[model samples]
Target: MQYKLITIEGNIGAGKTTLAKILSERLHGRLILESFEDNPFLPKFYKEPEKYSFPLELFFMAERFKQLQHSVNGPDLFHDTTISDYVFIKSLLFAKVTLAEDEYKLYKRLFHIINKQLPNPDILIYLHVPIQKLQKNIQTRDRSYEQSIPDEYLQKIQNTYLEYLKQSDQKVLFVEAENADFLTDSKHVDLILDALSKDYSPGKHYLQLS
Candidate 1:
């Protein structure tokens, strides 16, 4: 109620997309899900990250920019609020983990330039699940490429995301999801709704299942 655009984000397999979908339906908001299944570099990147990391991230950044620019900037008469499963800054966070230092530096420059053209979320709910929980969820989803994702990689990504969350200037609900499942738990949904109903200064706000 206090936000015009709500973003659901987290490490891989944290169920952000499911949460975003549920919130969009409940709020009668426009849902913008990242369409990554078609990316040619994704599977290759997982198998050979050293060789494909740059291309993988580059393609993702381009696609995310194009998608968000179109979806967020367009007029939507039917829905007053917009719910997205990702925040644009995740691109930088992820690239920091996967790219070489020089590549990341260059990518960061491009990201800053492209990001200026997109609007930030009014509130971003970052679901923080343990690496083991995230691994289990990733396995359950059964994406062949993601099945082989090492725990070390997941840990790096989690660390990067946490660092960014701590320094973020935007309103963020830092939520722990190790004990909750947004798809099967009604309480989890209520928790998200309650978090979004209040206003907060631009900074991190901690949340949990309870």
Candidate 2:
């Protein structure tokens, strides 16, 4: 792998973890998967977003900071390529959509403080899936908390991610992934692998594996 770190991100059920696992195994790279299941607030958040949004986001921000410090930011082999299913910025993106305006201001302040001390991904791969497809995937997964996630919420989060990524200075791969399936299709993995193997100028790069 050419990049030291690669991050795959998308809406709730966009298969970020699946692709991260595939690339990690194929390249023998270090993998950092998001532990969303372990969060105690997630279930309550979906059931009552207004009541739980702030704490849910706060919990995630802390967990992500600690996890990254333990894994990607560890005192390990500098040669090892690290792949993560989500980035630190994800906390902020989700917060923007879920938190109250005052709560979000505080969240962003905390986020920027933690973010500056962490390492940015060499490349951020955004798997672009439509809201309809995302909802289908969410339902197929059968997560009780995720079952009620409204399409409007997903759309807001998606828009937040796109806006931030578009203006970012880091290298980003915008994969039009409405039809891409890394788990079932080898070519889909190949397309991502190809992107990982080459270096790109810092900007948005588009791909459609068809």
Candidate 3:
């Protein structure tokens, strides 16, 4: 099937943005990147997760909703393909992991409302890697705000992603980033394209690009 909207999802440092860029270029699709740098609450959340989790999640949720709205109404709406670095649901996953009980309740209520209003992706590609690998990637990238992220927190985020994908109704493509070099490998791109074009069963699946 040809995808009009494709979303790439993963924990921070899992390389969703990189793969989205590559896929957009290769597929000649318009790119919709998450504005992480523009998020004011992000740095504070990293510094004090318990104190700022709700605000950070809320900000991301709102931003993603706006992006989804634009993607559906913008010039790319009629285009055959479009790619986004982050999925809107990923905000809920993060909120579940980081927010306090009361905070999460409020967040969920708001999320449900926002979710009802946003457009859904035609295909969602979820990327997974070990916490150690994620930490290594984070260190290599050297984003100052991300340097304070704990391994335990990263693990929680990754677990939430797995659970969310497992229960999601959307057409999902799960890719293990344990050894995949999406930036350098043409075979990986081919595998993703093949998966997008084919009709496959839901649940967790892997594509070994050879």
Candidates in order, TM-scores: namely 0.98, 0.97, 0.92
Best model number under TM-score: 1
How much does candidate 1 score in TM-score?
0.98
The runs of at least 3 residues in candidate 2 whose Cα sits more than 4 Å from the true structure, single-residue gaps closed, are none
Instruction: Give the higher-TM-score candidate: 1 or 3.
Output: 1
Candidate 2, 88-195: lDDT as tens digits: 999999999999999999999899988988998999999999999999999998988788888899999899999998799999999999998788899999988887
- What Cα-based lDDT does every candidate model obtain? 0.92, 0.90, 0.82
RMSD for all candidates, in order, please. 0.9, 1.2, 1.8
Error of 1 at 13 (Å): 0.6
Per-residue CA lDDT of candidate 3, range 94-197, in tens?
Answer: 88898888888999898898788777888788888888888989999999999978889998888888877768777788887777787778788788887888
Model 1 / residue 177 / CA error / Å: 0.7
Overall local distance difference test of candidate 1: 0.92
Candidate number of the best lDDT: 1
Backbone collisions counted per model: 0, 0, 0
Error of 2 at 55 (Å): 0.4
In model 1, pairs of residues that clash are: none
lDDT score, candidate 3, position 65: 85
